[model samples]
Target: MRLPTLASTVERRLLVNYRVDPPAISRLLPAALRPQLVAGYAVAGICLIRLGNVRPTWAPKAVGLRSENAAHRIAVEWDGPDGIQTGVYIPRRDTGSRLNTWAGGRIFPGEHHIADFQVHETGKELHVSYTTRDDATRVEIAATVDDDLHDSRLFSNLEQVSAFFRRGSAGYSATKTGHHLDGMRLDTRRWQVTACQAQRATSTFFENPDRFPPGAATFDCALLMRDIPARWHSLPAMPVETDVSGSVPSDARM
Candidate 1:
């Protein structure tokens, strides 16, 4: 059957304000992490806090599955000296299922560290709680995910590169399959490196941007990291698993 489009029905609310100062950010991060920062703008960093309710028109029996009725989500974005980072916090129960096979085995494919999240709803507001690493820094994202934004096509191209990187297989290449954005191109490359860490999860790193056709600017280098919840393997066959602890698995290997 045809699944109803929750994309159009999803609603967003602004709960907390996000803030970041470029100078303050520069002073906070280590020198090795600076290259990931986006340049040409003084704004350098951003903070974002959003509260939104989503109602899916249908429901499935698997875990981590999005409900067809309604649910809530809070997402944050931040830019810092190391790189641009974003996190979305979704209360565990809001998701009807716990299996996230849609990740295509790229994430949450096995059992690992997962935690119960708590969210409280009062009138039109929802309260959420989460924790970050002690040494790890947190920055608020200033950018917003546009309601009408549809970049799945672009993301798909990026994912192709991400998949190859995850396997640690060499001699792969990415070419521009298509372009939905002006400055972005679909890239396929060879000799990509897959780096996986216990606490950092898995990522594919590309050393050269010139492998693909020339665009207005070269990406220089690119990396795709997969962020999957730890308890993925324990609860198999579910649509989604919500008990995310914001921590990568302890056993991830390169």
Candidate 2:
């Protein structure tokens, strides 16, 4: 009897669902503090908040700057049923100065999925872009911030945030989890992925400490599989629950 030889196989992909764009470098810093804060973008659902700031150890006063100042803040909220997502920008010269506050809730109607967001600097302008999917509807948005602004701190921070979503929780209530990444700390309950497709989609909750000073700021992002037996209407009509104690969800079991 003759035996046949077997071939070995290698899997090239990792199990992680997140993908990060290469960190972009810039010389847009003051001469003395140039080595401290390195500017870059991180992608999450619908584009997470971008950031540009000096390192924690570098005191703003060392460069004749104040820590209590913000150049501007741009906020975008989606309302699923109304078929519109609204964005607002507030410019602040001093930290004590307050921008117009926005309440948290659904900002747009019929929004099913949101992703592919980026914020970049072009000369003196700041640009932001994102894609929204509402049921059978699809739309893309690109906006720019072009005003003579000497505040690099606010611009640096805004340039660091980006987001992407796999599934649509159109009416789900988001919980907060207390966590921090880089200088940004998230203080809220954590969200768990319930019914994700091909392990590409997962749910996460984050709170941006820099933007929401005293109160906690929170948002959600996830990756979704392209095609499967699942339809937008096949999912449950209930909101996914959050684990305040960091317990894993039962639905996450494969």
- Highest TM-score scorer: 1
Q: Count the backbone clashes (under 3 Å) in each candidate.
A: 47, 43
Mind giving the per-residue lDDT tens digits that candidate 1 earns over 1-254?
A: 12222211112222221122234323222221221222321111111112122223243223223311111111223353496533321111112123321321223221111222333433323333322222121211112222231232222344453442233211111111111100101122332322111111110111113211223222122221111211111111212111255322111110
Error of 2 at 162 (Å): 21
User: lDDT of candidate 1?
Assistant: 0.21
How many Å off is the CA of 164 in candidate 2? 27
Regions of model 1 farther than 4 Å from truth: 1-15, 26-64, 67-115, 131-254
Model 2: C-alpha RMSD to truth?
23.8
lDDT, candidates in the order shown: 0.21, 0.21
